[model samples]
Target chain A: EAGVTQSPTHLIKTRGQQATLRCSPISGHTSVYWYQQALGLGLQFLLWYDEGEERNRGNFPPRFSGRQFPNYSSELNVNALELEDSALYLCASSSRLGYEQFFGPGTRLTVL
Target chain B: QQQVKQSPQSLIVQKGGISIINCAYENTAFDYFPWYQQFPGKGPALLIAIRPDVSEKKEGRFTISFNKSAKQFSLHIMDSQPGDSATYFCAARWGGTSYGKLTFGQGTILTVHP
Candidate 1:
């Protein structure tokens, strides 16, 4: 089976612009997670979606939002992107009843 | 507390030696502890995972030693090889309303020399 997949391996944007990143979870997986790996910040959970509902979120700002589709794919949206937003955004997937998570290659977003 | 503190941000070990990385988490509610390995330009892959119920779990050359009361865990790679050079991360997650959310520690870069 294929692991989690992300699109637009690299994204570029300027300050005040918005950026959208996408992810597709493995088949039979119903839970998707988004994480931001910013420089020196480590990997921080951004959002968690299961069964098309936003389950939980991290301590990120309101600008960071995302949603999961019926197919379990997810999209992470960063509004009013700042230079600090330049980092690798990763998406992970797991069975709704599982604790093991599989991650995607991530989309490297560069904000100027 | 949802923080996982990892020690020795970087590690160097000789081939055929042992590489040890330690991590201490602050949250006692975290029942699942996992270690991840990541190569540059790639996403992290699950190396091993252990629940607090077990003190140790070993797979192949990797071993996870968990200390539930101490809220600490360590990863030991036996007979480490050059191919093991990569970044390693320790993560923790709780259940219930906080399920599906993982708090990862600052990664440790391991460099194995031949």
Candidate 2:
């Protein structure tokens, strides 16, 4: 079976602009999660969506938001992007709430 | 605040030697511990995981030793190979409300020299 897949393998945007990243979960997976990995840093949880509802989010600012579709696909949107936002945004999916997560290659977002 | 703390920011191990990475968590509520391996420019992949009920779990050459009372866990790679060189991360997650969210460690870059 295919693992999680992300779109726009790489993205570029200017400060104050908006950026949207997409993710499709593996078949039979119902939970989608978003994480941000800054250069030389570990992954930071961004958001979690289960059954098309926002479950929980991390300590990130309000500008970082995302939603999951009925099909278990997810989109992470960053508004007023800052230079610090330039990082790898990863998406993961799990079959259930407490199962192991399968991650995608991630979308590298560069803010200029 | 870093809930999970990992040590030995970088490690160097000879091929066929043993490589060990240690991590300690602050939250006793965290019951699920997992280790992830990531290559350059790639997302982290789950290496192995264990629950609080078990003290150890091994898969192939990878093993996880968990200490529930100490709130610590360590990943040991036996017969390490150059192909196993990568950044390893230890993570923890608790059930109920934080069920699917994982708190990750800073990560350890391992280089296995052949």
Candidate 3:
């Protein structure tokens, strides 16, 4: 089976601009998750979406937000992007709430 | 706040030797504890996982040893190979969280030399 897939493998944006990252979960998966991997830093949870509903979120700021579509795909939007926003944004999916999560290739976001 | 702490920011081991990485958690509920392997350019992939009830779980040459009392867990790579070099992360999640909404460690970069 195809694992999670993300779009715009690489994205470049400037300070104060906005960036949008997309993710398509694996087939038959209902829960989608977003995370930020900043260079040497480890992965930090960003948001969680399940069955078209916003389930939970992480410690990130309000400027960082996202939504899940009816088809279980997800989008992460970072507004007022700052240099600190530059990182590899990863997406993952699972069939249930507490199952194995499969991750995507990730999108490398560069904010200048 | 829940947290997963990983040790040895980096490690180097000769080929065919054993490589071990350690992690500790703050006891945030619990249903799953997982380890992920990632190369330089790719996202992490689940290497192996264990539930709290099990003291240890093994797959292939990889093994995870969990100590419930100490709230510590570790990953042991037996017969470590050069190809096994990569960044390995330990993560945990409680019952109220989603599958991927995990509390991850800082990650350990393992370098196995030939």
Per-model TM-score, in order, reads 0.98, 0.98, 0.96
Task: Give the per-residue lDDT digits (tens) of candidate 3, residues A15-94.
Answer: 99999999999999999999999976678889989999888898899999999998999999999999999999999998
Evaluate residue B81 in candidate 1 and report its C-alpha lDDT on the 0 to 100 scale: 98
List residue ranges in candidate 2 displaced over 4 A: none
Candidate 3 residue-wise lDDT, B1-114, digit = tens: 438899989999999999999999886576689999999899999999999999999999999999988999999999999999999999997675343568889999999999
Steric clash pairs (candidate 3):
none
- Candidate 2, residues B1-114, lDDT tens digits: the string is 889999889999999999999999888778689899999989899989999999999999999999888888999999999999999999997677676798899999999999
lDDT of 3 at B56: 98
> Could you give candidate 1's per-residue lDDT for residues B1-114 as a string of tens digits?
538999789999999999999999887778799999999999999999999999999999999999888889999999999999999999998776787699998999999999
Residue-level lDDT of model 2, residues A1-112, one tens digit each, is 8899999999999999999999999999999999999977678999999999999999899999999988889999999999999999999999876469889999999999
Per-residue alpha-carbon lDDT of model 1 for A1-112, expressed as tens digits? Answer: 8889999999999999999999999999999999999889889999999999999999999999998988889999999999999999999999997899999999999998
lDDT of 3: 0.91
- In terms of lDDT, the poorest run of 10 residues in model 3 chain B is B93-102
Model 2 earns a TM-score of: 0.98
Chain B TM-scores of the candidates? 0.96, 0.96, 0.93
Give the TM-score of candidate 1 (chain A).
Answer: 0.98
Best by lDDT: 1
